[model samples]
Target: EKVQLLIARKIELFWTRNFSEAIPYNNLVIGVPKEVWRNEKRIALTPSIAANLVKKGFRVRIERNAGLNAMFSNEEFEKEGATICNKSECFQSDIILKVRQPLISEVDEFNEEATIISFLYPAQNQQLINKLSV
Candidate 1:
């Protein structure tokens, strides 16, 4: 079973490298930062979800108090193996998840080539798209 899993992983790696520009889940550092958009009180991830990702070997980092608005405590996330980090540290992650588009200042904090998963309407978010496109 272990050998099969290894072979499958190898196949997945090869497929990603040759076909898609996708990163392996286990190799990703996923960050959940606090929603800073006006009147936004949502978070991208919850403690239970983060815990599942951790179990799958993904590194999860959540900004301190990111879940406060969602009613999910930092302690809950910590107990589930997610690191409670500051804003800068969270934004530095390889994968940043957010409830809405980030502010300009927040965009500057992302490491080069970082991937952000968030809601975006290109027509209304041209500036953000242009910035990220480069």
Candidate 2:
């Protein structure tokens, strides 16, 4: 019981120390795009995670139906302060998060200054790397 109490206290302290104050808004935006890779069903960010980011003063934009495959509804994300937008609008964000590598053609939709985070198999898809590097 005592050990459990100590662990709980530590967890509480961690949350308080990290999330007690909202970070000043610096115009940082994170976009979540739907997985286009075949058989990929997971989404990069969940509604809860988006909510946390919003509380920290970050803007989150999710492409329409991005989380549908993961059993998360668009309304769920919107309730957490995320904006649901079309794929093109979501791709315009400063940072893009995806569960799988985007299609080669979709790479051209990304903003030149945007950063992409996803499970990429660069070794197997040299063409994708070349396109993304351009």
Q: What is the lDDT of residue 81 in candidate 2?
A: 98
lDDT of 1 by residue, 55-88 (tens): 9889999999999988999999999999999999
lDDT (10s digit) by residue, model 2, range 1-134: 99999999999998777555643555888999888878888999999999999998889999999999999999999999999999999999989998788899999999888989987799988999999998
Candidate 1's C-alpha runs over 4 A off are 1-24
Q: What TM-score number comes out for model 1?
A: 0.81
Error of 1 at 10 (Å): 24
lDDT of 1 at 58: 95
Scored by CA lDDT, what does every candidate get? 0.89, 0.91
Best by lDDT: 2
